[model samples]
Target: MTSLSPAPLISLTWTDHVTGTEGYLVVDRLVRGVSSGGLRMREGCSLAEVAGLARGMSMKEALHFDADNPGARYIPLGGAKGGIDCDPRAPGAYGVLVRFLRAMRPYVEHVWTTGEDLGLSQDLVDRAATEAGLVSTVQAAYPLLDDETGARRRLAEAFAVTVDGIGLDELVGGCGVAESALAAMDRAGVPHGGARVSLQGFGTMGGATARFLSRAGLTVVAVADVEGTIGNPAGLDVEALLAARDAHGTVDRGALRHGDRELPADAWLAADAEVLVPAAVSYAVNTVNQAAIKARWVVEAANMPVLPEAESLLAGRGVTVLPDVVVNSGTNAWWWWTLFGDIGPDAEEAFAHTRRSMRALTDRVLERAAADGCTPRTAAHALVADRLPVMAERFGWYR
Candidate 1:
């Protein structure tokens, strides 16, 4: 194990509002590194959750370094997350959001750069950035779209043209939880074509995932946003849904009615499908709704979408649950590696490289899990744990 320095300490502070509610800003494991993870915001976000995500970023950086030719040394990159506690669904929340951003401007500028996440839109991010007088570059001018088609087009073409020597055909599996789910399905002998799918979120990751699966011949039957859940067993119009979705990740209610059923807030989980993607928020599949899940396979598109008890329950019911860490790590990895601008030709190439790396990593984890008779989650964690100590040692943190 490579050991160098101790993991840096992180701190968080909560500020109370006049309504007796509180919001938090958390810093986790800063390496005095060149870049820091983007800030994510959502309701009911906790310090522990932010810390966990930050730690994941650290591990991701370490793993990327390990994979470098001749073994790249660790660079000083850090992780941080912040969020407000109020419901973004409420009226005049924009003003509240502005206030929150302004309040944290000083600290944010000093240590972190905020980015879009659940309950936060790119438009919102730009507004916040503008208000804080932060520089707005790197495709920040575009309107928010759930599908992220532009981003994906860049990512796909780049991977096919730049990274994979065999060209686009060899760029079969990309990355993220979506790739992990695909890997699992391949392992279980489940065919991809005509498979029913229902997605709970329609954000950048969720929308891109839906498109990827659809292109691969899966039938996306339902998609849910914060506005409402829309289902059509005959297959949803992914393009139409994308067109109707607003900046807040909510779809317009006035859109086409095609024997569509409007389900309750959590009804997306109950949609009959071969695969269910919980891509919206954390703990969406908690104890309260564990039994309601009917999908044969649940792929976590969001961080910690499934609770421990819920996961165990799903396992007992013969439902496979793919872990979020390795799945979501694709985008996270791309973002981090691109910090140096030396990763590839453009952002798209960087993202494609990230996908390839993630696919290979997921495949190895799945193979090891099957060979060792353990869960994919267990095997992935074991792989990371085994490597982290070595990385720490190589950096002289351990003696």
Candidate 2:
């Protein structure tokens, strides 16, 4: 059974009255009357982009389903996504966000549960949601919880968790990404000790990924932020750079050491590294820039960071592109895992669950790719194809 339909279940567009900015919400699928995804704010976000992201969310949700494991409590929701076409750093951006939330509040209260994505943060989203008079971003899912109060408390407690000054919510996704990369290395027989990585975008996902991978013995040779690219052939200090980042993930240039060399922004595409992570904007690695990449693996830490044509080109050159639907799904899954009682509100438990789940999924995707002689993304789609039918049969598609 195919997981994708010709079009989304529902799509809405809103225009902010004050700033004339545009916002979009695409509900690609619905299970038990609700869907899950993130709300991203950026200058050029469009309906088409949000639709693609929503569809990806659906696949991501289905890929994590272990229907055989009856003990699992975290049932994957349907996929959805929200996007706003306005720069988050622009003047009156906050006001625009509040208005967008207000306009999208009905969907939030009834069908779609959202959090930070791309150019926004959870704190910012939560604050704006409150200003929009909403109960919570995930209020739509309250009906699915057996103990709503306890679930809310558990989620709140989990969000309060901090390991070495970083929030657990922020670290879980990165943990998943790092584990996936490690799984790929294991499949290829590459030692982690001297494996090099270059990352684009040092925000929540990128910064957290750098931390986990660096701690796991991978040398982060270059990291790109809004300012530019910072490189150190001998490997940069991951912790120091992470500490110097802003909420939007831009690193403070003042924190660079003498040995650190500044390179052009897109130079990260060509860094001498074993792994390249595009954790920033969509279509970051397009056909033109894909030629510059020399990494063995392109680990997608962001949604649709590598264009399809670029991925095909990379594949022709023998580069493996780990699909984002599987690679960067930890953060979304972690929220449900904690809220639905599949896992507790502790850092170790969260990390353990994310690692096990992501590694297994990665291995399965890689193995499927090998067996079918297809790309990892196609293998992931094949996996989703098997599970989405079961979810629909059990939950009644639109529920």
Cα RMSD of all models vs. native, in order, equals: 7.3, 0.9
Q: Model 1: number of clashes?
A: 21
Q: Give the TM-scores of the predictions, in the order they appear.
A: 0.78, 0.99
TM-score of 1: 0.78
Off by over 4 Å in 1: 1-8, 16-21, 32-35, 59-65, 71-78, 89-114, 133-175, 342-351, 394-399
> Which whole-number lDDT from 0 to 100 does residue 186 have in model 2?
92
Best-performing candidate as measured by lDDT: 2
> Which predicted model would earn the best TM-score?
2
Tell me the deviation in Å of residue 224 in model 1.
Answer: 1.6
> Which run of 10 residues does model 1 get worst, by summed lDDT?
137-146
**In model 2, what is the error at residue 366, expressed in angstroms?**
0.6
- Residues 1-399, model 1: lDDT tens digits: 232224435455556453444555655543332224445666677777766666655555544554455532224244456666667766755666666666666655555544656676655766876775655312221122233454435434444452322222212223355666777777788899978899988866677677667766788888888767888898877767666766555778677577777777777888889899988888888877989888888887787789888888888898877777667766555543433333533535554565567667778777877788877677766776666655554443211
